[model samples]
Target: MLFEKPLTLEDIKKEPFIIEHIKWDAGPKELMEPSIVPSCDGFIKKEPLKGYIFYIDTMGDKPVLSLMRHTEAGFAETLAQLDDMPDELLKEAIDESKGKGCFGMYPINEKIKALLKKELGAG
Candidate 1:
C-alpha cells in the first residue's frame, strides 16, 4: 500500500531484503549503465538518472511499497507506491521503459514486474 510520506534514504537502508532483491534479482543490468544525452556537438554520457527501484518501506505502522528513481547526484527520490498508480498507466510505464538503452529509463523485465506486483498485492 502507499505510504502517507515519501520514503527516505534512512528508511530504505533499514530494509536489507529490498536492497538485496534490487541488487541481485530485480534490478536490471542496464540500471548500472550511464545515461546518454544528445549534446550540441555529439552525445554526452552522464550519471544514470530516472531509473526506478522497488522497495518496501517499513518505517510506518505497516510495510509500504515504494517506488523511487535515482537522482543526478546518485541519491534516490521516492516517486509513488502501487496504490497510487492505475493499472493501465503502470503497464504503459513498464512497456515504455523497455529497450531504451538505460538512458533516463528503467527497463522493467519479467522478474521485476512479478516482484512489483507481488509486493503491491496485485499478483
Candidate 2:
C-alpha cells in the first residue's frame, strides 16, 4: 500500500522505528526499517524506536549538510554540522542510508518536500 502521507519529525519522535508504508517503484510499497545500520548488517541499535532521525537542512542562516542522519547521541556528537560540509557529501550518506543493503530511506511526504524546498529556496 502506498502511503500518501509523508512522516514528520514529530511522528518519528513519537515512535522510533515505527514501520511506515512507503511508495516503492520497483514493486509494491514496502515498510522502511526504522534504523538499519548497514555497518552491522541491518542491526538496529535500540530494540524499541524512541528517538527519530533528524535531517539538518540549515543551522542558523547558513545551510549545512542537508540529508545527513542524526539520532539523539548522533546529533550531539556531530553538533548539527558545525563544520562546513560539501553538498555532494550528503548524497553519499543518503545513498548509503537508502541502499539495497539497508531497509531504505524514509519517505518524505509531499508537504515536507514543499516545506523543505521553500526553506531551502527551491531546488
Candidate 3:
C-alpha cells in the first residue's frame, strides 16, 4: 500500500509489535578519529553511520517490513518492501546471518527474524 504522506520515526514508534520485538537502540556506527591532543580517553568514539533503517510501513493492508536509508535529514530513500519474502528464504537468510558483523549487513537481523515469524504465523 501507498502512504499519503511519508513515514517518519514517529510512525515507527507507534507500532507496539515493533516496539516490543525489534531492537531499536542499536545500529551501524563508525569510529571517529581520536583527538590529536587528547587526555586519557580510553573509550572509542563512535558516531551513527548512514545505513538502512528498518521499520514497519503500515500503508498496506498488512504491516510490511520496509527498508529505508537514513539521511542527514532523516529517513529518506525507500530501498525495498520486504514483506513478500518466501518463508523458507526468510528462515535461511536469518540463519545464515547469525553471528555476523554490522558492516554491509542487517545489524537487527534477529529482530527481523522475530518480526517475520510473527508475520508469517510461524510462532
Candidate 4:
C-alpha cells in the first residue's frame, strides 16, 4: 500500500537505502550481496554489469566503504535505466497501482534521481 501523499526524494534520502518495489513485476526490486562480483574485485569507483555479475567497489576510505557493494549509477547501468526509464512504463505502473487501490509505491533514490534530472538535459 502507498501513502496518500508520497514520500519525496528528500525524505527518502534520510534512509540508509532506497528501494523501488515494482508491483506485479515478476522479479524482486534488487538483490544485494556483501561482496561485489568480478568487475570491481579490486575496489573501483564504478563498473558496468555484464552478462551476470555487476561489480561494486568500495575504496576502503570511508568506514562503510568496505561494505559498499554498488552505487546508484552502477545500479541503473546494470539493471534498468531508472533515470532514463520510458514514460510508458511509468504510466503502466500508475495504472496498475490504481487498479490495486494503491496510490503508488517507490523508494526515492537521490543519486539516480539526480542523474535522471541531468539526463533530462534542461537546466
Candidate 5:
C-alpha cells in the first residue's frame, strides 16, 4: 500500500514527524519572544519558520530524505551563510570527517524508498 499512486507535497504532509517538529508562524508575533531572546526589542528583523520542508534527493542508486525546519529566510540562505569557505577549505573539512555520519540527511529505508518511487512515478 506504499504509494499506490504518485505523490505530491500534500501527500508528503501526511507524514507524522513532519507535522510535529515543524512550527509555522502565522504572523510576526510568532517569530520572536522576549522570554527566549531577551534582546528582541519587541520585534524580530528576520522571518521565522513559515512551513515544513520535506525534500527528497537521489544519491547514487538510493533515495535520500531531507527534513529541514524551514524559515521565511529559507534553507539555502542559511546553508550559504554557514559554508563561508573556499572550495579547497570545504574539501579539507569534508576529508577530515570522512567516517562521521552527515547531519540531517539520511538514506531512505529500502521499503520506504520503493514506496516513494511508486509515489514519484519512478517505479
Candidate 6:
C-alpha cells in the first residue's frame, strides 16, 4: 500500500538516504562503497520505503527495507549537478523545449526523477 507521510526539513537535513536496515546504530555501513547517499553533504531526512523495498546484501540478519528522502533543496541541487548546468539555464531549456517529444528534461530528467523517487520510496 502507498503511504503519504510528511517529513520535516530538519530531519531531511540530517540524512538524505533512509536506510531502514538496522537503523544507524548497527555500526559502520556494511557496504564499503555507499551506493545511495545523502545530498547537501548530509542534510536530509530519508523515509523508509513504503512499497517494494529493495534488498541490500550488505545488511544481513536484521534486514530492513529502506529508502532515502531529501528536501526540495536537494532536488534543486541534483537538478543542477546531474546535468552540470545551472538551474536558470536548465529551466530555460525546459521552457524552450516544452511540447517537443523528449524535450529538455523529459527523457533524462525522467530517469533522474525516478532514481530520486526510488531513493525516497515507492513512486
User: Can you write out model 4's per-residue Cα lDDT over 2-72, one digit (the tens) per residue?
Assistant: 22343443433343333332211211123332235445457533333212111112122211100112343
lDDT of 2 by residue, 1-123 (tens): 112344343433343233221111211012233334555565555432222222423334543432333233423122123224444453443443453322223333344444444543434
| Model 2 clashes, total count | 2
Q: How well does candidate 3 match the true structure in TM-score terms?
A: 0.32
Query: What digit string (tens of lDDT, one per residue) describes model 5 on residues 22-121?
Result: 3321211233322234344764444346554333232333333433344556432111111212334334433443433234232223344344445534
lDDT of each: 0.50, 0.33, 0.46, 0.28, 0.36, 0.29
Q: Can you rank all candidates by lDDT, best first? A: 1, 3, 5, 2, 6, 4
Off by over 4 Å in 1: 1-50, 83-123
- TM-scores for candidates 1 onward, in order: 0.32, 0.22, 0.32, 0.19, 0.23, 0.18
For 1-123, candidate 1 gives per-residue lDDT tens digits of 234676564554555544543422234344556578789999998755444565443344443445666555666666554454344544554565555423233444455456554553442
Residue-pair clashes, model 1: 0
Q: How many residue pairs clash in each candidate?
A: 0, 2, 0, 0, 0, 9
Over the stretch 1-123, how does candidate 6's per-residue lDDT look in tens digits?
A: 112443332333344343232122221122222335679887455442221111111132321222222232322111111222234543443344345322112212343334444544523
lDDT of 6 at 67: 28
How close is each model in CA RMSD to the real structure? 12.7, 15.1, 13.0, 15.8, 14.2, 17.9
Clashing pairs in 4: none
- Which window of 10 residues has the lowest lDDT sum in candidate 5? 76-85
Which clashing pairs does model 3 show?
none
Error of 1 at 68 (Å): 0.7
Cα deviation of 69 in candidate 4 (Å)? 12
